[model samples]
Target: MMGNKILRKIVATVKSESKGINYFSHQSTAADSYVYSILVDETSDISSCEQVSICIRYCNSQFQSQEDFVGFYATSKTDSFTLYNLVKDSLLRLGLSIDKLRGQGYDGGANVAGKISGLQKRLSDDYPRALYFHCAGHNLNLVVQDACQMSPVIGDAMSCLNKVVVYIRDSPKRWDSFNTLLASHEEVSGCNIRPLCATRWVLKLQSVDAFLHTYEVILDFMQTAHSEKSNSASMRSTAFSLLRKLEDFTLYFSLRLLQVLFKAVDPVHRNIQSKTITIGEVLTQVSSLANFLASNASFIASNAKNDDSVAHFTSCKEFASKLHLNFACVPRGVRVSAEDYFCGLYTGLFQTASESILIRFQAKSLQMAENLRRVLEDESIEDGIIKTVSEFYDDWNYIDILRERRQWFNICRHEGLQPSINSLRTQFKSELTYKLLLPNIRSALTLYIVIPATTCEAERSFSALRRLKTYLRSTQTQVRLNNLALMHIHRDDFIKKVDLDDAMNEFIDRTTTRRNKFGIGNK
Candidate 1:
């Protein structure tokens, strides 16, 4: 009991600024903590290749208020499951649910997978039409990865180059020397020796000819390094590997490759600011790109073969099988059924696979469904449970105005029904409406949007963690570290009543004071 009290107090203080919660402990793994799940719908645009995921809870159409966070549990042991449970529990503690969910986006890892048991499957089972979308950017990556692999030499080159980067970056002195040599090059070497970022390399592949012009400068730098230490076989190997890799890179980046890259970047540019994109948009874009690529492959390949230095472009015969696999996974371009989509979205987003299990809880003594069934069949389903479900189904269908043409609802003032309709609208706007609609809409939106999406939105805590654990300072206990991380999440909530900027500034100042007092940066 004493330990428990102390632990609680420590967590409270950590949360004051760190704004995160730790769930790896034995306590968090309990059944109670795993009760709810979080869902997120994600979309990746093929044109620009940016992915966005949205977290939400179900409520009536009129419900439009936003919650700071929502909480739920994932039904599995994967990253998506862990992320969903943590985010959902945290948000629920603050009074949010799936009713507020709007969209979801992801790049489709096992944790973020949109398939069944994948985040999408889980979310759709709970929330209907929560819009499980594949990331277009990821599909493009697959295309590029396949294209690169088609030429074994290119694949080897990329692998070799990646290793070279890792080796140099790992050795600070070597990396610094490499940078210095580039900066000191007397002619046309004024360009900064930029850090080898992954995305930039992909872009470089589109213009291999431009890079080939500067290959000599890199070789000169390698030669100079080798001359400085004649006994360094390691240095010679690195230089030779880098040259070989560049050759393969240049060979692979012909006009065909450039066009394919352009297709992927276009969609990413369109939705850089959006928090989430729908599945329909992603499927449509990918399908179009695949069709175009398939049709133009022969022309592109013919041009590649004519280039004297092209050496090896991915052949049409070799690429067709991979393209077919990608095409098979691409969602059909036809309009998906709104009702079916919504049902799957909610179920996958909100409800855990094990949700229907009662565990130790007994069945309700009061019978409600049978009584409501009569009213549902005969008289109009008014503003009760049946009415809540009815409104939820219709509201969900209308939420994604992008799916179909938007149509306005017409409430004919049929005397008594007018008052009821108005009352329903008013009730729909309430928080209670979200709670009531949970049962019906849970399957459609919960699994995909709620369960896979996370509330680990502590932008402040990440900053704090970086400050605490820098490249120079990297020793800490796992327990203390967990406590510290949790503090980051709580800190966001703690300062909700205070000015966020002021709190962050104060926290920074405190860290600066500690650094100065400890003489931490006095090199």
Candidate 2:
């Protein structure tokens, strides 16, 4: 029963390895060429312990962008004052200079993103160049969440789907039963079930799509559970209620509509997660998606039957033609015609998504980032725009700014070279104002490149958080947990480079008995 004396040493060695690998990644920020951005988000552990994740995005010596999980801070208070101080101390510990921070991104929590006293406001006060923007990915999720709020049917359907998936997955017998059905049912033989994510709604697309394909099988399973006479009365009642909700036509249509709608927003949502995606690019992609939804809304509106004359019912007719659908009651307590209700719902979804996107993206924080985009992609050079760009980086010397502007116009002449911020950084080595002499231009470009567009990577670290700090490992110390999380999030960046044999030997002398056998300090 290796009661784990040796296992403890292995864990200790892994913790040391995590620390060494993370410190190595931290050295990238020590570069004279590095200007980094901060991404901070607070999440609780399984034990409900609140901690903040601090990630820094910067371009490495290779000029490739990196968003590295740098540290975690545990604190009792999450107020902006406490959080701001915690962030400062964390950076100081890592030996990263506050002067090098060029941007800051976080979700729209009032304590974090508020203009007056929020963390962003505090950060921008001291580090003016650390411009703030609402995280683009969270903004997209908010768009989906806002649209979901508009339709009660969507809310109800989400509840039903989420509960049913959890109900089955909670019990091993139920999960195994569901798996057996998936294997046997021909309509969705190989399909899997995914629970709807509670935090980010855009991620719910996969969960919704999975259940849609497996809907029939789930229905069959529920039907058997409800009808089985030997089942407990409470169990049968619960199963019956869930089954009725599943069988509702409104819920089914909501699921179907959400499938298509989520698919519509998927591309923009996905593109926003990129490290190099600027606010301008995200706005462009969002505008395109909004236009697509608008077109679909128009099609749906004109095709559905209305109170006037005869209508085509093109979309509704097409969808309902294949399967039987019931005319369900709306919130007003009257059963409406299938042609009108579903079409209106479909059009409403498109309208909701488009409107929410347009409204939410018009934030004041994005104005500066948009200005940077104009300088990069816009052919017509405007002095006013140049002033805005230079003012954003007001820390730069005036002479350098003047020269960079000349180099900038010259670079703009080669229209073909204007693609992405990253590509431009690469192209600059040879042609940035006559042999890359523009140091300010290079640094400015690096600054904008490192300014993270979204906090998606920080959110990704939360998944690792759950994996590393499960209930069984709940007793792990905070330092140990942080080390393990940094290693887990950044394993690919440094795992292959770790010298495991040396790491083991370094941690081999933990216990006195083991040290005696190893002859440590015997000489």
Candidate 3:
């Protein structure tokens, strides 16, 4: 009971500190109170109750980057305007002004991203400085989704993979049988498989990797289950159906193609997902992925030359993926040759992926970011670039920014430093000269760094909520859950410095009855 009391006190401190009184920049001080950005994402908890999680990304007084969870607000209405009001109220509660917001980050969902009626559009009406950039991580996820949906064969392959995974894993006896078969096979790497996911990497690439590894083991498992007379008719029927689906050369090829595509896409996705990476680094990753897609399309086009024996090898029969036994490239009874059908698929896949990335990443956002890179580049900035950047900022004048942008570029060139956001951020913090010399440029640099690359912090908050709030604890108040979530999600920031006794005393002082009982007076 004492341990529980102590634990509660400690977490309560997490909630108190996370209200962020110390982290808050007083609006009165220009230097300490920096312009910040927000990352927003929504999820339904176990009870199917919808809630929005808000996190702020900004540079601290020490000029170090911070992405901290503010709070979660449950809402029945989720349209652009209502969601904005919820966000506005949440920000008001946190003592942050909407006018000071410099950037907005969210997924590609229409509710948030729609230019006409979306939350981004509504927020811009209120504060023009809050430029919305689609989350870079979600952009990559959408790219993969677009590529998969472009082809019907690939879609069916994905569905087949999901069905097989669910069917075998749903029954304990079947799961045990599958693992036993894996144990007997010395060649299998013992990697596990899972369902494919749209929003996360969890159900995606690694699952494809494991499935590719245990191809023959799976075939044997399916064949044995179907052939056994003692097995349930449903099990036999399912096994037999999936066995045929697996033997379809098109399905096999499509899955392999997906594995390779995701392999290329995952690295870029990982780069965007990393909190340490700046938007500048993320933009570089975007360019790199584009180049890979271009080259991969060429590689796929060149695969048109493989003949029957080369594609369907009988010698290496143990490895089923490598040795193709069936070559029916039929879709809905429409027969097509493997060479013609697969060649189109392999080439068209990356072509669609490249197009999706280009469309989804948005030229306007890229141009906005690239214009700032001019401050770190060798090029001479003219009046037009200054006007565009200043217009986005909406701070009344483009004249002062022109001078700062020029001087900032000169400083970078004079120092012979690489032109990156991280490099500029380090110099700005370490050298007091830069801050005093170019205040406008400093503000721009600070705001640029605060602009979020991803909403992964908000997603992480949801994950912490899943652990802290379970089915049995469904009756707990949302405010209490929010407080606990603040402690659990941002525990690393609080673990070492926070004192439990101080937190409990503080909590007691805030309450009228507790203060009277403890005989503590307000300072």
Candidate 4:
């Protein structure tokens, strides 16, 4: 009874403080298990920033018609209708209208991304306004993966880099020796080798950076291992071959190219993972990055035409300087000039990556993003605003409120207020939420604010699930697991908002006999 009271109080606080649950991120944890997380915008009383919290609605393994807990079910089948029905039932049980859902985020999978019979397609049939987007971070990873795979030279170079990390990590002696050498070098002291993971593309950047930073130490360790009597002949042979490959000019050129390309996209990648970022901002960053890469390709091609060795070497030095690589150490046997290498890399890798990003992000998603951008930027009632209202507000009916809003917008502009969306929202939050405002206009604005630009929140919940349901606690019941996971994930909220005195009073009221028996007194 005490726990039930506390749970009700917490839910009440969330529902009262939040305007509405605007977006949901869903992911399947196992073949038979799934989790749906709710995200809502909570205004901070103390600051201007809005906080996003993940309320875990369902985490279970039961398959039935109308099963409780906001739709977690276990089933043998994996089809679009099954998933859609689960979500629909869950939303209905929560008393949330399907019409209010503005966005859906998921991993790029056939069951989710398929155009004909996918979960996204099925959901769109009922809620055409709810947009489906593949997770932005995952798309960036795909870009890197595709670019690397398209070039055999880059692939082989990455393999060699991975092999180097593995060779040292697999043996304690070699690993210790590498560390010892690293410490002995003053310039590279305290640098640790980073292992590359196939699934995590960001680690590729770290791996390459670590290798370059500790190059001399790694080379020294490899030479020592080659001469060690305890080392097998095959091990020595492999070490010698790897050492030669690491020193090759072509490998360094490939590394430099990848480093530059990753550097360009890394900022945008990090930005999209943020729960607070809007789709408009993400699209802008992506478009800018694509353009940046295109210009870089053109620059490389232009430089490739110069045949003067002095000029060629200067270009090499300039490129290496940006990556902090020692261009003087590049071997003479690599006859391909730096410009030629960069041109090839730009054509084979960066250009394809840029094109791939634009291709994968759907045209409809881009159009919506542009509409939001225009709404955020424009100061007056323009064609873009009309287009937005027509496309998003067909069901809305409060023209008087919209007219008032337009008048307020003009007044703000006349008073010299900046025309940015954030500025407008900040100045007119009350008007936007007033009862007189058209419900459709309010809904559109609120949805734009709360629509998740990424599925990072869902991914984070999956990570928490893994930690909570580790091998040692694998046999715990689903209810217990769900409670524990919620407590752990929302510890911040519990610390900040939960009142101990109220909970204790409720506990005392529910267990009077136990309280009397223990002679416990309330403060």
Q: What is the lDDT of candidate 1?
A: 0.37
Write one digit per residue (lDDT tens) for candidate 2, span 363-435: 7667777766655545465777767777767644445656665666676566655545655656664453432
lDDT of 4: 0.59
Clashing pairs in 2: none
User: Against the true structure, what is each candidate's TM-score?
Assistant: 0.45, 0.81, 0.86, 0.77
What is every candidate's alpha-carbon RMSD to the true fold?
16.9, 7.0, 5.5, 9.6
User: Comparing 2 and 3 by lDDT, which wins?
Assistant: 3
Report the Cα lDDT for residue 53, model 1: 25
lDDT by residue (tens digit), candidate 4, 1-523 = 3223335544443233223221222332122112222431111111222212223222111110010111123333456676677667755555455665556666667776678988778887787766677777787788788778877778887888889999999988888878877888889888777777777685577778887777667777888888888999999998988877766656766776677777887788887776556666777788898887665544344454322323434555665566444454423576775556545555557667877877876657556755655554554547546556556634333453356457546766687866555654554454534323333333344445544466566556556666766667766665565566566665664534668777667567566696787577644
* lDDT by residue (tens digit), candidate 3, 124-189: 888887888888888787788889888888889888998888888998998998999888988784
Pick by lDDT: which candidate is best?
3
In order, what lDDT does every prediction score? 0.37, 0.71, 0.72, 0.59
Where is model 1 more than 4 Å wrong at Cα? 1-88, 99-106, 111-116, 136-139, 164-177, 184-190, 193-213, 226-231, 241-273, 276-392, 396-523
TM-score rank order: 3, 2, 4, 1
lDDT of 3 at 447: 59
Q: How far out, in Å, is residue 221 in model 1?
A: 2.0
**Model 4 alpha-carbon miss at residue 65, Å:** 33
Give Cα distance to truth, residue 475, candidate 3, Å: 0.6
For model 3 the local lDDT of residue 371 reads: 78
